[model samples]
Target: MTRSVALLAVLAVALLTALSSIFIVDERQKALVLQFGRVVDVKEDPGLAFKLPLIQEVVYYDDRILSRDLDPIEVTPLDDRRLVVDAFARYRIADVNQFRQATGAAGDQSIAVAGRRLDSILRSQTREILGSVSSNDILSSDRAALMLRIRNGAIRDAEALGLEVIDVRLKRTDLPRENLDATFARMRAEREREATDERARGQEAAQRIRAQADRTVVELTSDARRDAEIIRGEADANRNAIFAEAYGADAEFFQFYRSLAAYRASLLEGNSTMVISPDSEFFNYLKSDLGTQ
Candidate 1:
């Protein structure tokens, strides 16, 4: 009976110790067991785990992707342009041993403190990189290259803290509100001046074209008039020539007929003629025998 009672006590104690050794590993967590204040083992797998009861302690940490948003920082571009940058970073603990050694069992304290230090470090690095680049370069789509360089630099600096930065992204970049208004004013003035100059040049070109067209119209009208005058003069000369030829073929008949036409045109209707002697030279043709016939 005494032997059985001692064996039962031992089994009860063992059961109690076994119950105390029970631990859990979640899908996103990794744990480290410390024996006598020294890291004895690390549990990286999920599900139920056991450790030396009342002698070992467990430290749990997240292994999933973690992100932190940094504060706003000022960066100066190569063109002397000032910009405000707001960014965030993604990271995951890659080396558990290094993480533990660097953090010194501070656990979550490292992340909270890192958040502050990283803000200052990133701000400084951002200003350095931005100061080396032009404003246009920073504003361009290729600024991703600059971002990659900064992220790599951050990763190198963060290696001492056992933090692995997966990527860094710039969320917003903008000029200060005080400078924005001034910039817009200057841009508006420049655009207005350009528009005015363009309009003036267009008007000048149109005037030149219109003047040239008017000169051409005048030249065409003058040329047509000269040609028409020449043609009319030619027709008049032909008619005169025909009359002269016809008259030259019979001079005496032409003279007599012309004088009679002139007398008929000068005499008035129903008037008695009271001229000089009828034997005048004007009446010589009338006195001739041909005139009598």
Candidate 2:
């Protein structure tokens, strides 16, 4: 019985030692072997990894890329325009040993510390670089170039933290709430001024066109009146010439025709009245005999 118990105890001890000596590293993870609070080995491959039981411990970190969204920070540009900028970054632990040394911690704590450091770097760099340029540049097509500069600057600064900053992006940029109202008011005023100027110019052009049209109309009316008067004068002169020619051709016949015309004019209206003697020159044709007079 004593010999059997001793063998079973040995088997139990072996099982515990074997279990404690092995660790797993997944395809997406990396492992660090720390002995007595000091990093001794780094396991970057997948599958089972070995370490001394009860003396060395394993710490795993994700090898995949990680993302962090930073808080919005306010910055002022060279034009003295205030803007709130929200940014984010994509990073990964490139060197596990360096990362561990840099953070002086392991696991989640190290990641958190590194993230905070990167956040600080990004905020400071964003402020400095963006603040140096004018607000118009920030709002213009040059924004892409400015963001690239910020990203590059951040990548350089983030290297010390063992972080590979793959990409840095600006998520949002806007004017502060305090300035929005004032900005809108100023813009409205500018538009109003422009509209007023446009209206003034339009009215001036309209007036000039109207004056030209009026002048043209007056000239047309004057020409029409002058032509009508000239035509009337010519017609009158032709009638007078016909009358003189008829009188010269036959004096008696002309006098008779003129007296007949006068009688028709005076008697055409039923209410018309004329006072004259029957023997007067106006009625001589009516009083005399036509064949012998």
For this target, which candidate reaches the highest lDDT against the unseen true structure?
A: 2
lDDT against the true structure, per candidate, is 0.81, 0.90
Backbone clash pairs for candidate 1 read: none
> What TM-score does each of the candidates earn?
0.69, 0.85
223-282, model 1: which lDDT tens digit per residue?
A: 999999999999999977876776898767776777688667767689757567866666
> What would the per-residue lDDT of candidate 2 be over residues 136-240, giving only the tens digit for each residue?
888775577887888889888888887888888888888998798888999999999999999999999999999999999999999999999999999999999
Per-residue lDDT of 70 in model 1: 80
Q: Which stretches of candidate 1 lie over 4 Å from their true place?
A: 1-16, 34-41, 96-110, 235-293
Candidate 2 at residue 69, lDDT? Answer: 94
